[model samples]
Each structure stands twice: as structure tokens, then as C-alpha cells.
Target: MQETLTRLTFPLSTTSAPCSEEEFVARFNQRPGKEARMGYDCPLCRNKEFVLRVENGFHRPYACRCVTIRQNLTRLRNRGLLELYERCTFENYHVTEEWQRGARDCALSFQKSPLDGWFFISGPSGCGKTHLCTAIASQLILSGHDVQIHRWVEWAAQAKAAVTDSGAYAALVQPLKDCEVLYLDDFLKVQHGTRPTAADIRLAFEVLDTRYNTPDKPVLLSSELSLRQIAALDEALAGRIAERSRNHAVQIGSAPGRNYRFK
Candidate 1:
């Protein structure tokens, strides 16, 4: 492995410059193994020594490429993919000491098992529920999981539009059904005539039903609605969600001097 990596170099002069002893010495000196191996003996490449076989092929008599490639792949999987996480910051997301500890614990637990569980974060506006939920989603994505975020009103509008168009409905449903993590922010923000429309209730139920039925894979939800409020929207859907969800909830207190908004 050492010899192969050391021997690897960029061609300096292309075919214009013929190999010379001085050039060879200079290039060899620049190589990684030259200085160390010149004085020490390599047991693996010594006379009568046995060579190991790798998945690619038998190791070279003095150098192995397989080990280098394996190391590179392992490093890439760990560090390279971590860079893909999408981070968002908001001025109102004040992480209290207690919440910070909880967040750390939550992150560690997710890193370990990464189970498909539901999370409901309910709080008045400007309480940082959305910020924290998105932070969690970003962390999960960095760990090589798929995550999707949607505003409650926007999602309702889209789903409503989809009801009249089969293709549109499928497009919306597939991601909601398949994503590793799905975040629904500002739940219950969609307006209806005095109560949630039958279609709205049905759409919500369909999503919850799919997740509830799939035991191996579950969905996560972040909503501004309290349990009681949610139950009021659709009792049957609420019951189904309660039955399958892991029952994680976060409630942030409204900050002082900040007005709360309800829809």
C-alpha cells in the first residue's frame, strides 16, 4: 500500500522529457515511502514471503491498492456526507439550557438507532418550534437520511389541488409516504368554513393511516396543534395517530412581549 501510494505522481513533462537518473532520484525522493523504506526492511515483500488476496485481486508484491481504496471510501462516507446537512437559523430560536440538554440527548439517540418515530412540537408563533424541528431534520439528513419539510397551509393547498388531479396527488403522496422524515410545520393553519373540511380531514387521515399501517417504517410530524386541538380536528385521525406515534411532544412557552397568533 505504501509503495503504490508513494509511486503515484503527476507526470511533470509529459513525453517531452525522457526519464533521467537525476529526475528519477528527485521524483523518488518526493514519493512517500522512499525515505522510510530505504533503511528499513519490508517483511511482506521480503523473499519467500506470502502475499494476501483482496476482493479486487491479489495484493501487489510490494504495494496494495485495495486497502487504500477501502480507507478512502470509509472516510468519504463519514466526513464527506456530513457536509450535506441543510442548516437554518432564526433570531427567535433561543435554546434554553434545559432544551439544549434535551436536544443533545435527542440527537444522540437518533444517531444511535434512528427509529421512525413521531414528534409533535406545539407552541405559539415565535416560540421556535419550526426552527428546532428543522434543526433536527437537518441533523437527520446529515446522517444520510431523506427529510422533507412543508408548511401546513401550503401542504393543504397542494393536497387540495391534487384531489382534482391524479398525477398531482401521486406526486405529493409519494414523497410524504417514502421520505425517512416528514415535517409538517404550523399544523392546522389551513382555514375551513367553521371547521376543517371533509377533504382536509380525509387528506390528513390518509397520511396518518399510511404511516400507522407501516410498522417497519413510521413518519414524524411536527405540528403547532396541541393533542386536544388535533383530536378536535378529526377524532378518528387523531386516534390513529396516537395509536402508532411514539408520543414525543415539545411545547415551547410564548416569549414575553411577543404576541401569539392563532389560526
Candidate 2:
């Protein structure tokens, strides 16, 4: 079968190394048909996105490494997070302090085992909270999970606008309640650093409670307010967040060197 496949495949090279994405595109004048094919550029799996391997005296289809790349790109693009995903990778995340390193570890843990539980990081601006959350979103995308990057301030505004229209409200907010992964950045964050209003607290409970009841679907959050601060405003919402993120929560203080903005 190996010999048969080798003989049938066209325009594939002898080298085992795969072509870079740029090189692959350069090899073809136009994108292949809607369906994948054994095109000229891809030597690994010949562009079928999966390869057949001998197993139990039969051949089984196994996903190629390249499939992961394509999936990540597609999902990121669809969710409008491609640029951020490319930029805020775990590899490029800077860690200058011990607490920062711990925060990164928490994000990595959640990214690796998303079904495990929720992850939270609360810190001042320029503390790399969004970067870590973006890192998690990228990894979740790479691992074939749909991630919703919820900029909480903007999201809340949209939800608030649609509140009077039941259909529009559900259209705007229902996805967050049931998304595979929801990364809420700046949860309950007020512009002047004031506490959230009763409405903000209620909106948070409406969305968060759904995820709270469904433990299998995990969440990621970054906020300027720490869990304790959130508890002071509304203990029920904060308690659920604290319990879910118990294992993977890290709060970076405003102590000297904690805020990278000064540097």
C-alpha cells in the first residue's frame, strides 16, 4: 500500500520535511477546489489533510499535523482573533517577576486541560492579563475549540442595548452562555475604576451562571477587580467565579514592578 500510494501521489518530493505555508501556496497557482486534494505543494498526506496508516492489518485515517495549522487559522479568522492570536503567543509572553510566571502557568494549565475548570487573572493594566488570556484563546483554537474573546465592557454595552428586545438580546448574549470557551476580559470593569452597577452585576450573573452550572464547559477571565473586590459587590457571582477558578486563579497586586507599564 505504501508503494502504491507513493506511486500514485503527484508532484510530491522525496524529502520528508513539510513545506512552509508560504512555500505551499507558492507551489499552486490557485487554491485547490472546495475539497482538498493530493496537490503539488504538500508532501505530507498530499493535501488531503489526513493520512492513512497501517493499523491492525488495515489502514486507518489519521489527521496530519498540517490539519491543526489549518484549523487554527480558520477558527481564529472566523472569530476575528487571528491577529491577536498570532501576536500574543505563550512563547512571546514576557515574565519578569515570580508572580507573573505563576500567572502564565495558570493560563497554560487551563489551555492544556480546558475541561478541567475555569481560569482567572485579575491585575492592573499593563500586567499582561490580556496577553495570557489571548494565549489561552490561541491554544484553545489550535486544539479545535471555539473560543469567544469577550471584551466585557463592549459586550455588556451591546447586551444592554438589546435588553428591551428579547429576540435581539438572546441573539447577542446566548452564544456566550453556551460557547465552548468564553474569555471575559475586564469583567465588571468600570471606566473610572468605580464599582459595577447593579445592572452590570446582574448581566454577569446571567451569563456566568450558565457556565457555572455546566462544569464541562470552562471559562477564562481577566479583570482589574480581584475576586475579593467582586465578592464585595455581589457575593453570588464572585463566589461562583472563585469556586470555578479556585485551582487556576492568580491575582497580581499593584506592588512595585508588578505593573509593566512604567517600564
Candidate 3:
């Protein structure tokens, strides 16, 4: 009777503690953002990943303009596509040569397409390959696709370094193989503009083959080498990329005029 009376008088709470802001934002990054979900990452107000301003001198329980950039930064950090992310857009790509106009048009078309095939662009240095690739990635991101820009030269080195450990290697390479869209920047590029090594071929094949086999996975490849050049080095790998991108490939000629840095 005494125990029953105590239980009745002071019942345990049924509800859990409210979720923390950090925890909530982490979850939010992984899904489509909640509408009207307003917060900030200012350490002055709180730990920062996003919001930069408080509205009307009130704490940031309300949305502000900086949230968009904040959200973009958070998203880019979450994805592997961090560099050139803030600025790359269709509007930013300059149209100089007739080929540039064509390239821009091709990029826009790829951005607007159903995204069933790969996008391959090859050009000499300074042809804006990375810029165009990033522009496409930015658009896909806004559409809520999980996109990553794999800086092939740098990312490949990282993949090579991680090979010392099996789990670490997989963790590094897994995203390249599985992301919704992958922008492979500077594909098969090497120091002194030399051809890729055998190790490079193996690594490239591992990631490209997996994506190649999956018909629905869309890949964007930008290389200093043309498809013909890549095919010369490794036809099997180049064949997969070429076959997938046959519908949307752009190859800029290696004219001194094609390189804008000369001017």
C-alpha cells in the first residue's frame, strides 16, 4: 500500500529530454532540411556549423540569410566536394571561344538532363574543366542529390595512402563508388603531364568499374587527357568511361588557343 502510494504520488516522466542542437543539425544534414527550421552555428550564440546572424536582436530561433551559405558549407563538408564549391555556378563560367560556348551549353544540358548517363569533358589545361564540373555538382546539390567532387589527383593519393589498412582503404574509396553523383576532377592526371602509372590504373579501375557496372550511377569526369589519349593508356578503363558518356562527352582540342592562360 505504501509503495503503491509513492508510485502514484511521484510518477516517472514518460518524455525524454529535448534533442540537442548539434545532434539535430547532424540529423538535418543527412536528410532534406526541415522547412522553417531555423538555427545558427555562431559560437557567440552557439557552436557553429551554419547561422551567422540573429534577427531583430533576438537569438537565432529564426532563419536568416546566412543560413543558405552555412547550409552549403555544412553540406560540402559532409560530401567530399569541398573545394570551388562556394563559387562554381553556370553563370560564373566565362564564354570566350566558340568551343567555350559549346562547352557551357553541354554542361547546362547535362545539369538539366534526366542524369541517366555519365558526363565526360576533356581539355588542355585552363579550359575550365573543373569549373564546369563544379557547376554541374552545385546544381545537383540544390536538387537534394548527394554529390561529391573527387579531385582525382589528390583523392587518388589519399586512396593510395589508406591502402596500408584494409578498412581505412575501403572507407576512403567507398564514397567515390557509392555517392549519388561523383564529379571526378582532373581524371588520370599525373605530375609533369606524364601518363598514369600501373597503380593509378588499378585504383581507377576499381572505382570506375564498380560505377560502370551500375547503369544508373551517374559520373562526371574532367581530364586533361582526351578520350583517345586515355584509351591509348588503358582502353578497358577508358572504354567504360567513354561508353557511359557517349551521349554527353565534350573533347576540347589541344590548341594553344584553347588554353586561355596563354593570353
Candidate 4:
């Protein structure tokens, strides 16, 4: 295994442009014919002695193209994108309303140059806020960064469970505090006609405060409430999010027609 690993040669970084599922399969599926194997060599395994070994009479294959491909795939999957593996990309997102178009542009810009800082997308329900945030998160993950996509309600549930066990809550939410990119979806998504309770606000404050104090971890946040509404809910927390967002923030809907869920 050590010899195989030492003989492997492939770009570990993921910088290639994103490809469609069909394109990806086609690119990797084109294998050389078996009859042409005499002079052929594996790009990653080098077709050398390290490519195979005999382990107690059993012929074991070591380094190969398949292993290299698996290693690359494992890195991408390790980004913690369980719920967002598909349909969470810039190409998958569609812009219908004027605000959604602007939001799409802003999301693409952030994907291209993420160092611009925290990106906040706020609006009414079904306004493509989550879609935009997911698109950005997908880009970051593909670019080889550790990213966490936390749902606000799910996280609040953890906070509820943590009322007695502080350690449990910390274990659940610590990834949000330290990931390379954190996408907090449906921020403060409380029931309709009711605002978040004091406990809810406190939970949000803790997470946002941790990220705010520890700089450079770009946050991609989306909510059914506008920035002003978030500020009205909790001034200090909103202030921290706003300060980091700066010009990168993109707000969507204001009134009823902006809701795109029905469409």
C-alpha cells in the first residue's frame, strides 16, 4: 500500500469546471481497448510493480485509475453535503422574478470570489433564497472546501435538546462555528404570524456570534424575513450579520406577489 501510494500521481485539487452527470460519466468511462494494453500505462498508477502485489498467494490490485477516481470523489463527498448532493448548483437555479435575477448574479459573483465576505439572502417564502444559498454552497464544496449546510429549524431542535445538556448542543453546532463555509438556511423559520421566541433568538445569537468573532469563515444565509425584520427581531445578532455582509448582501421580496412557491 505504501509503495502504491508513493507511486500514485494525480492532481489532488478539484479545480475543473463542474460537469453534467452525463458528461462526467462519459469523460471517465472512455477506457482503452484490452488488446492495446501492451504499451499502455495508467496515468495515476504508472503501470509499474506498485500497481499490484501478492499477499500470501492472493493477487491484490493496488494503485489504479479507479482508486484515484474514488479518492477524488471521497474528498468531494466529505464536505458534508448529504441533503444537497443534487439540484444545488448555479446551473440548476432559475431566475424568474427581477429580485431573483439579481440574487442569482450576486450568488454567482460570490461563488467566483468568495473572499468578499458573508452573503445574506432574505425575503418571503418560496423566493429562491434557499436555492441561491445552496448554489453558492455547492460551488464552495466543489472547489474543495469544508462546508456545512445547517437548517435553522433543525438546529433550533438541537438547541431545544441542549437545554439540559450543553455538551450535546456544542457537539451539534460546533461545525457551524468552524467550517470553511456555513450556509444557514431558513434562518429563524418560525411558524407563520409569529416571531421567534427569546430562546430561538439566543440560539441564533450564539452561532452568529461565534462565526463573527472568528473571521474569514464566509456565511451564506437565507431567511423568509427581510434584513430589517431580522434586525427588528434581534438588533445585536442582525448587526453582526449585517456588518459582515456589507455590499455582498442580497435581499429579495417585500410584499405578497414576490412569493414564488405557488408558481
Instruction: Pick out the ten consecutive residues of candidate 3 with the lowest summed lDDT.
Output: 51-60
Q: Among these predicted structures, which one has the highest TM-score? A: 2
Q: What is the lDDT of every predicted structure here? A: 0.53, 0.75, 0.71, 0.68
Superposed model 3: Cα runs more than 4 Å off: 1-72, 75-83, 257-263
Tell me the lDDT of model 1 at 15: 26
Candidate 1, TM-score vs. the true structure? 0.57
TM-score, one value per model? 0.57, 0.72, 0.69, 0.67
Candidate 3 yields a Cα-based lDDT of 0.71
Candidate with the larger lDDT of 2 and 3: 2
Which model, 1 or 2, shows the larger lDDT? 2
**Off by more than 4 A, model 4:** 1-84, 255-263
Number of the candidate with higher TM-score, 2 or 4: 2
Tens-digit lDDT track of model 3 for 146-212: 6666678889988888888999999999988998788888998889837799889999999999999
- On residues 1-263, what C-alpha lDDT tens digit does candidate 2 reach at each position? 45665553443343233764345434432334235522123456556565554444333445555565565566567768677778999999987777777788778877888888898888888889999998888777656576677789898989998899999999988989988888888888877946688889889999999889986878888898888889999999989988888788888889785632110
Please tell me which predicted candidate would have the highest lDDT against the true structure: 2
RMSD of 1: 14.0
- In the order shown, what is each candidate's alpha-carbon RMSD? 14.0, 8.8, 11.3, 11.1
TM-score of 2: 0.72
Instruction: For model 3, state the Cα shift of residue 80 in Å.
Output: 10
